[model samples]
Target: MPIAHIHVLAGHPRPVLKQLLREASAAFAQALDAPPERLQVWITEVDPELYAIAGEPADEVLARTPRAQAEIPLIRMALMEGRSTETLHRVMAALSATTARVLGGDPQRVRVQIDHVHPDRWAIGGVPASQARAAELARRAAGQGG
Candidate 1:
């Protein structure tokens, strides 16, 4: 499972927020080989006055550079450990690409951070994720999709 926490300056309309969630989930599902059913997304909107860039508040930045608003989406993703470095890099790139496509931001400005946690530290239904991962791998090895 992967959880993406998106932070943005407050005051986007509902539709934009909805699209962010939808598009980000699809990006993770496709890029990380995870099912959408296991993807969790959370959006946190910070007050413009509380967010700053290069020592200026969001409103000040916007006043100085209108395009700064489109560059404000910050995403933090948490995933299970044990994935290869190539997989992580691919997912990060895909996430940035999808975010730019969905939000019309400059791809260079899309910020993404991924944190990998040991599966033994995560659990579902009292079973550690490492155990679940083993089972899932066995299923895959046996020609059953996990």
Candidate 2:
């Protein structure tokens, strides 16, 4: 399974946020070669007063700069380790483009961090993924042919 957490400043329209979730899930599914039903993408909205940049609150920063220019979104992705570097790069580009297109910001302003966890370190239903998802993992390794 792959999970993505996108952090953005609060106050964006609900429709935009919903679009982000839907599009981001599609991006991850296509780039990571995972089933869309198995992927999770969520948004975390933060208050401007609680977020800071360059020692100033985001609320103050946006007051001086246009919201579109100043808003920066942080995305964190967690997945099982073992994907090729090419796949990782592709997912990053896909996510950046998706964020920029949906949120009306520069793609460069989007930050993505991917954490590849060992299967043994991840759990499903209280069982280590390595043990619980062995057949699924094998199918994935075999070009998703199963």
lDDT of each: 0.79, 0.90
Model 2 misplaced regions, further than 4 Å: 144-146
**Residue 33 of model 1, lDDT score:** 82
Measured by lDDT, the strongest candidate is: 2
- Estimate, for each residue in 45-99, the C-alpha lDDT of model 1 and write its tens digit: 8887878877777877776776544446788999886666887888889878777
Model 2: residue 113 alpha-carbon error in angstroms: 0.5
lDDT of 2 by residue, 1-146 (tens): 78999999998999999999999999989988787998999999999999997789999998898877888899999978878789899999999999989999999999999999999999999999999989988986876732
The top-ranked prediction according to TM-score is 2
Per-model TM values vs. the true structure? 0.86, 0.94
Task: Give the least accurate 10-residue stretch of model 2, judged by summed lDDT.
Answer: 137-146
Q: Where does candidate 2 clash, by residue pair? A: none
